[model samples]
Target: MEEFNGNDQAFTRDSLYGTASEPTYAGVTSFMRRRYSRDLQGVDLVVSGVPFDTATTNRPGTRFGPRAIRTASVTSAWERHYPWEFDPFDHLAVIDYGDCNFDHALPHKIPAAIEAHAEHIVQAGCAMLTLGGDHFISYPLLKAHARKYGALS
Candidate 1:
């Protein structure tokens, strides 16, 4: 078990690696309790939220999916990942990058905003695990990723 120094490791922990020791219910919510940081230095992967749902004409509530997923992940963050004896954090450096910021009013710019946001991270040599807003959001994300890694499947 990891050492428990206090709580709110999402904001308090300084390292980009290791499982958080804070209680699941007591700390700032980040994906799996990973620290919230924009710095890509030494980071292996970034879990970012893209909260835009204007494309989902039939179901517009998908914008809230990212936050809901993050909140739900709080519990799993402190527990051992299933189907494995070890935590991936033991060898990986991950962080929760919060969400993509864009003007919802400017729907045309949303795709670009998400693309740029992804480009910034991918360009920094970091892999992304995005919590999406809608199915359409994948277009921009894939475009950005394809630019870096080429023709994503």
Candidate 2:
């Protein structure tokens, strides 16, 4: 197992229930170096990105948040995370679903796009870990989540 986990498990591993010990600077930069899969068969969680920031009243650079976050996640991809007794990947089948696809030209429709993206995962019985874009991304995310699991704070 050590021989396999020692390399790029992001696209090489056959399973989604273990850790990836690839060099922090190399390999597919998926969230936590997890496999970049759209298959939700038995997945417990889906990490996706929403690169939309046009709605922000402040700076409009948040469109790149998702990519930035994915890059940063690499620094902590190996072994057990600090302060935690166990690695979540060891128990949960997590995958990087990549970024939400939407027409940035149609800002009005981005919210619905985000909502639907989340709904697909939730409906599949998998949890979501959305990244990037702006806080407004929450508006659509919460709506999708509420539909699946009921009221949320």
Candidate 3:
């Protein structure tokens, strides 16, 4: 575990696919293994990759959006500026929980897997920030969250 700056926190890497000799960009293993400046217990946000883009309109590679976002977020070195003058990474606890596993053989399995995973996260008392395979992924995420926390009614 590595700490950025003088922060006394370490990020843990968790993979659903198990470990491999090399990292995988298309799966959850790569996303979870990135270093960050916070601990899971102290995390205010858990960003995850939900790479399932069966409904892509143009390019099909949008399914990889989650992995791309995770890479961008971790590699970013932007400092905060404004009323608050601290690094956002230093203050907010965020982790990449990696991608939700979906069955490519069965299209319906995508939504089911997403909902199940999101429910578990919500039940754990953490807010889920997810990457999309497509915009349609939002529907299951919201549905699961709403079921647990109730809708905006």
Candidate 4:
């Protein structure tokens, strides 16, 4: 288990797989625990966020959306929900794979960053549920999905 002394947190290597190398971000396992109550052995769905809004009307903080959503998801976990009775966690595996790190210094890099990041997830054979950094982020996400699944038309 990898232990962090500053936050008094400890997580196994398995829990940290596929997570960013930086310690600031939460691991997939921790995100899953915050979002659902089930083991993630054969999860069918993936919930991800793309917090890279360089083109927003007010662009200063849209990059923070991923962190905000993750916080809210953790808060909502213990709250009562109708689906709780059905144990939705047992049926599905949900995770937040953190956010796509944008190169704010080079705004033009956003499209490629978003495309590559989303493609990694799609290629892993997981369904994506993404939060937005900006509207443009969705375009690359859709394109990546289309490349993987082919165009509907």
Stretches > 4 Å off in candidate 3: 1-42, 78-84
Q: Kindly list the per-residue Cα lDDT of model 3 for residues 88-140, writing each as its tens digit.
A: 44445556666678887899777888898888777777787787778888888
Q: Tell me the spans in candidate 1 whose CA falls farther than 4 Å from its real position.
A: none
lDDT of 1 by residue, 18-134 (tens): 675666778788888888998899999999999888887777888899899988998887767788998888788999999999999999888899999999999999999999888
Write one digit per residue (lDDT tens) for candidate 2, span 24-109: 87777888888889999999999999998887886999999989998899888777878988878888988999999999888788
**Model 1: number of clashes?**
0
Give per-residue lDDT, candidate 4, residue 105: 89
Instruction: After superposing candidate 4 on the true structure, give the runs of residues whose Cα lies further than 4 Å from its correct spot.
Output: 1-42, 83-85
Instruction: Assess each prediction's global lDDT (C-alpha) against the native.
Output: 0.87, 0.86, 0.59, 0.58
Q: How much does candidate 2 score in TM-score?
A: 0.92
For TM-score, candidate 1 versus 3, the one ahead is 1
Q: Superposing every Cα of model 3 onto the true structure, what RMSD results? A: 7.5
Model with the higher lDDT, candidate 3 or 4: 3
Query: How much is 10 displaced in model 3, in angstroms?
Result: 8.8
Q: Going through the candidates in order, what is the number of backbone clashes in each?
A: 0, 1, 0, 0
Q: What's the distance in Å from true for residue 16, model 3? A: 19
Question: Could you say which candidate leads in TM-score?
Answer: 1
